[model samples]
Target chain A: MPEPLLARSALRAHVAPEIAAPAPGVVLRERTDLTLASVAAFKGREAELADAVRSAYGIELPTTPTRVAAGEVAFVWAGPGKWLATATGPVDFSTLPAAVADQSDGRSVLSVSGERARETLATLIAIDLHPRAFTSGDAALTHAASISVHLWQTDDAPTYEIAVFRSYAATLWRWLVHAGQSRGIDAKL
Target chain B: MRIACPHCGLRGVDEFAYFGDASVTRPAADAAETAFADYVYLRDNPAGAHRELWSHALGCQSWLVVTRDTRSHAIETVEAARDVALARTSEAQS
Candidate 1:
């Protein structure tokens, strides 16, 4: 398959990494609900928004998009000046670039990774998360983990999750476990 | 790709549509059809920063001008530009 985006340098530069857990370990977990901190921002002037996002969050978006027309995604627009990015994976919040700013309402992140991580998620997420179609650096909004979440497949982290509200963390985690039980993914974390 | 429209907020990248080369001006239709054909078809498939136009067909339904790089898959700029503004900008010399 094609190489995943956010390679060695990029992942190190952006991911807010925590130590990887053992195989079959608790790969997915959500901390106590913390108020949502801004996760993204945009700046334009000489077409510097990508740089801005890189400088701010260390994530890079594709340019001169050559894919088929994306006229269907606009159906969810809720504001005039901002779009909420799906925040997932390990984030290094302290390194957020100064050029960009975060303006998200109270939101938080969830961590999901482990040997059984894929199997675990497969039970709950109706969609696919294979490396080919939903590999790292890809983001999708879906109803999974028992909540509406912005899913991010982190680079090399071997973990993934749905970025959801603090209130939904517990329920989502519970759902993740239930889905995995059949496959023996009784992750306690 | 989920693009955050400066005017329409965060929307799926699919909702916004792409236009032709943003920096190139469409040749006159009355002129040689061949040159116009080349204008319409031939393009510089560059590896770096490229400016193009896009429209939010599913969201605000407004036109936008964007600057992006192909090699790196990095978005440079996504701006709200009307048809007239984009045309004028395309016509301007660097």
Candidate 2:
């Protein structure tokens, strides 16, 4: 294999030196290796696009406003006639009238988990973080710390991924750390 | 205020960004000047239920047509704007 290129975290020097498990119930970590892409079906091509995605990725393209994941391949309902797809490795979509673009660099993801994770998020956002309402596999574009974030619950143990603009990574990290302090956060850098 | 996003369920008002008057549709360019002007600039400020467009900015980012009671701030119906627009376009073409 060819030598791998060096990739730097959006949080760079900020999260580098050490990965600390700061407090108690909350575990904070920055997930930088995932790949993300914006996928949109062109005008008059919705059905064909869905079929193509199903064939290409071995997963259905969600038409309804919901997030669905099959293993490491996940589709996030972004807007009308559009979805954002994320996967663990390289992402490619070969279909007519379908637009796919790399969004991995544009977005920075922060993962938070543990018992009080829901409570910690609730303190920052005005949305209802009730388990019954925002369940596992559910995703939404919402504001936290006054910044636009795509928040999703990956599993029932109250694990969440907050994806924000790479430019706002430091700010979001600070906000998360502060909010999670009360719940005792174990920050992994 | 809370708006029920059809796909995402009930969420706080802060997650949504509002656009006015989903009830309005632009007139054909060649139509009467006054009609075009009305469609572009005039909007109703109703005290009761109103139909308006709201984007779920913090989630899904989908445009929704929300039927809400202006006085009580209660949402009566919420739907994906794409469906509504597609229906209207097809109906007009048909």
Q: Clash pairs of candidate 2?
A: A23-A185, A24-A184, A140-B59, A141-B58, A141-B59, A142-B58
For residues B1-94, could you state the per-residue lDDT of candidate 1 as single tens digits? Answer: 6566665345556566888677666776688988888887888878898878887664445677777887875787787766547558677844
For model 1 chain B, give the 10-residue run with minimal summed lDDT.
B3-12
> Candidate 2 on A1-189: residue-level lDDT in tens?
899867667886675322335446888888876888888888888988888777766677766556788767888877667777888876564343588877888888889898999898888887777987778877777788789888888988789998888889888888888887767787765
Off by over 4 Å in 1: A1-26, A31-46, A54-105, A155-157, A186-189, B1-94
In model 1, state the lDDT of residue A120. 73
Top DockQ prediction, candidate number:
2
Query: True-contact fraction for model 1?
Result: 0.07
DockQ of the candidate models in sequence: 0.05, 0.50
Candidate 1, residue A99: how far the Cα is off, in Å: 12
Top model number, lDDT: 2
Output the worst ten-in-a-row residue range by lDDT, candidate 2 chain B.
B6-15
**Residue A14 lDDT (model 2):** 70
